[model samples]
Structure formats: structure tokens, C-alpha cells
Target: MEEVSTKPSGYKEYVAGLLAGVATVIVGHPFDTVKVKLQKHSTEVEGIKYRNGLHCTVRILATERVRRLYKGATSSFIGVAFESSLVFGIYSHTKNGPQPQVIIPSAAFGGAIISFVLCPSELVKHACNKAELLQCRMQVQGADLIVTGMFPGGSTALLRESVGNAVFFSLNTDSSDPHNLTDVGIGILTGGLGGVAFWSAVLPLDVAKTVIQTAPDKSCQRNPFQIYRRTGVRGCYAGLGPTIVRAFPANAAAIVTWKLAMKLLGIKNE
Candidate 1:
């Protein structure tokens, strides 16, 4: 039997993680804008209303002279780098075990486990985005306001990935041997399926998070359940379409980047 190495190639993994992070940000950014807008739409400060997703885009373009809807893109770039690094690191480690008898399921287990780090990011990103938006509004109108609020958007993000991975991995099966095109294909498929499952599961929570973050009613005490109840099922999942569309490609990029890194580093066991 080949000796099972505890430590795989760290440098390669790190490089792969970085590359994947950059790619995921680029691929997911547009959809992310749509998702954030949809989620944050109902939020209004006093009588000042931030428009819906389309209007938000138009306003940002027309008023702010920025075609990009997102204000703090640097936050996303850095966050994605960190998040993807952790995710890919964990994934490569878990996937190195004697080819999982049930490959995708094991992969999903790995994916869900990484949610711990990602969840906090979700919370911080939404908070920061809202804060920035509020700042922009106040600055534009020259109003005096101090905005401080915390929402547990990250909690559901972690939950979403955890649950989504569980569902996808449970359904996955693998027949490919090592170092084969078939193996790569299986990996890609596994990642794509896992991404879909993960995003779908979290769609509702994502919607709620957007609403809470952008809403100026910081004094209003409402829970996630309340947000869902207010929005109804459809409202809670308003941005599902865009999310699902982006997830597949983003996940595929991650998987491919990992494989390429592994190969380039000559870290193959075979």
C-alpha cells in the first residue's frame, strides 16, 4: 500500500486557493450585485428608499456615475480570497483520502465543513455594504446620522453550505480512477452539483439578510423567521435565479483550479 501522507503540497494548495478565489469573485460579482439588491430592496431609511435591483443599478450608474452596482468591491475581493483559500484548503485535504468510496458525498461533507469561516464573512459583508450605502446616502444629502446594527446573516450562510453539502454529497457517486480524465470530470460534476444544492438551500436566508442589512429600521427587532414570514416564500427566494446561474460556473472554476494546481505542483500520488 502507498504510504498515506498527512501533509499534501501546501504551496500548491495555497496558490490554487488564491487563483480560485480571484476567479470566483470575478465570476460571482455580477450575480452577487443582483442578489444583494434583491435582498436589500425593502429596506428604507425614513422616507428615503433604495430602489429595487434594476433601479439600484440604474441609479448607481446614472447618479453615482458608477456602472458597477456594488460600492465596496475591494471588500469582496479580499473576502473571496480568504474564503476561497480556506475552502480549497479544506477540500483538497478531505479529498486526498483514499478516493472516497462515495466521492461526491465526501466532497460535500468537506464543502459544508468550510462554512464556519464563510458565515462570518457573510455577516460582515452585508453589514459593511449597508453601512457604505447609508454613508453614501448621508454624504450625498448632507445628513447627520450614525448607523450601527448587527444582523446574523452569516449564521444562515454557514447553515446553507452545511445543509446544501449534505444533500449534494448524499446524492453523489463516483467511479473514476486516479489521474484520469474521468476523475477530473467527476470532480467538476461533484463541485457543480454541490454548488447548486448549497445556493438553493440558502436562497431564502440570503433574501432575508439583504432586507435586514439595507433597512434603516435598526430599532426594529425581527428574526430570520419573521423576515421570511414577511416576505413569504417567494419573496425570501427572490434572487434564487441569479444565484443558481452563477454558482455552477463559480464552483466549476474552483474545482478546475484545484486540479490544475495539484497537477502543476506534481503532487499526484499516482
Candidate 2:
């Protein structure tokens, strides 16, 4: 029987994920800020508030100064860095193996593993960005007192991407080459689908997360789940459309970047 060697240590993967996160934030924070703001303050004027990503960017830069545009960048630096570290590290290693099914579980596990660091940072950043996030909205949510709000937000991301990837790949094609254009396209499609699926499945959790993360210091009488349920289903997934749009391309970009980095470092897998 062939020997099955042990997978790489979690510590190494964690470091990779963190590094990727940091790199992503540095390159993408400005766009991220604009994306968040548009999602948060969506309006129904003549039907819609903002036209598209470009329009939103133009408006924000014209009005909200480039500096203020990235208000929660510091929090993002921490949150995303940790989140990506485990995500990419585990994903790259596990998916490269024979037993591909491990990818889903590993991805989910990676998300959970890194939540200890990600959740807190995300809570702080999202809370801090609440005002800017909902600038045009009338009754904006607050972003304070969110220590306990970590579970749902943190866990859902894990559940979404990890499980989503697993399910997606299972139903999709079986490609051996990650660098092929078709393979990359499939990855993008799978990522976007996964994002939508995750968002849909955990919209309620996200809504509560948004509330808690945004309003960290509020003394609300309602339970987190209770408030989410009351918002109706659609309300929970308020940003679902944009999120899906972002995920497909954004994650693909990250994957491409990581792969390029690996090649540069002379790393290869059979």
C-alpha cells in the first residue's frame, strides 16, 4: 500500500492565509470601502440609488475624500489578513491532494479556525464603518459592543465558502489543471455561486451580525436571531446581489495571485 503522508500543519496554513489577507486588503481596500458604502446605502430612486460599481466609485471619490473612503481599513487589515491566511493555505494544500472531498471540510474548518482572530477584527471594523456604510440611510445601525456577535458572523463565512466550495466542485467538472483558463473560469463561477449560496443560507445570521457589529454598544431588548427573523427573509440578505458579483471575480483574482506567488517561489504539486 502506498503511504499517505500527513497534511501540512495548520500553523503554516494560517500564516499563508494571514499573509494573503494582508496583501488583498492593501491592494483592494479602496474598492472594498466603496462597495460597502454602496451596498449599505442602496436607494430606490427612479427605482435604484446607484447605477453600478463605477458610478458608486465616482460618486464616493467626488464627495467622500479618498482618505475617508477607507475608514475601516485598519480593522479590515486584521480581519481579512487572518481570514485569508487559513483560507488559501488550507485550500491550496488540501485541494492539491488525491482525496479532493477533503477540500470542502478543510475550507470550512479553516474558516472556523481563523474566526478567533477574524471575528473580533471584523466586528470592530464593521462597527466603525457603520456610519459610513449607512451614510444615506435614515436609522443607521451602530457598530459597538460586539464581542459575543462573533459566532454567527465568523462561523457563517466558514460554512459558506468551505461548504459552498465542496458542494460546487462535487457537482461541477473534474479538472486537474488549476492554471488552465477553463479551470480558472470554473473556479470563478464556483466561487460566485458559493458566495450566493452562503449568503442565502446565512442571511439571518448576517443581518444580526451586521446589527451587532454595527451597533456594538446598543442595549437592545430583542435577541439577535429574533431581530433578524423580524426583518423578513429578503431583509437579511440585503447585500446578496453585490456580494455574489464581487465574490466570483474577487476570489478568482486571489487564487490567481496566490498561484503566481507559488510559481515565483518555485513551489509545485504533482
- Best lDDT among the predictions, by candidate number: 1
Taking the tens digit of each residue's C-alpha lDDT, what string does model 1 give over 1-270? 454334666666666677778777776676677566656566775554656556656655676665475555777778777767765555555664444454445455555656665654554554565677556545643433322233234455555665565555443333233357777777778767767877787677666666654555445433678887777888888867767877887776666655566565555522
TM-score of each: 0.61, 0.63
Residue 207 of model 2, lDDT score: 63
lDDT at position 261, candidate 1: 60
Error of 1 at 80 (Å): 1.0
- Which residue segments of model 1 deviate by more than 4 Å? 1-7, 30-75, 94-120, 127-151, 165-189, 212-222, 268-270
- Model 2 gets an lDDT of 0.56
lDDT (Cα, 0-100) at 53 in candidate 1: 56
Tell me the lDDT of model 1 at 178: 33
Instruction: Quickly count the clashes in candidate 2.
Output: 15
List, in order, the clash count of every candidate structure: 2, 15
Worst 10 residues of 2 by lDDT: 136-145
lDDT digits (tens) for residues 63-182 of candidate 2: 777876677788677767756766666665666554556555655565556556656666555645566533422233334223344443555444444554455333332332456778
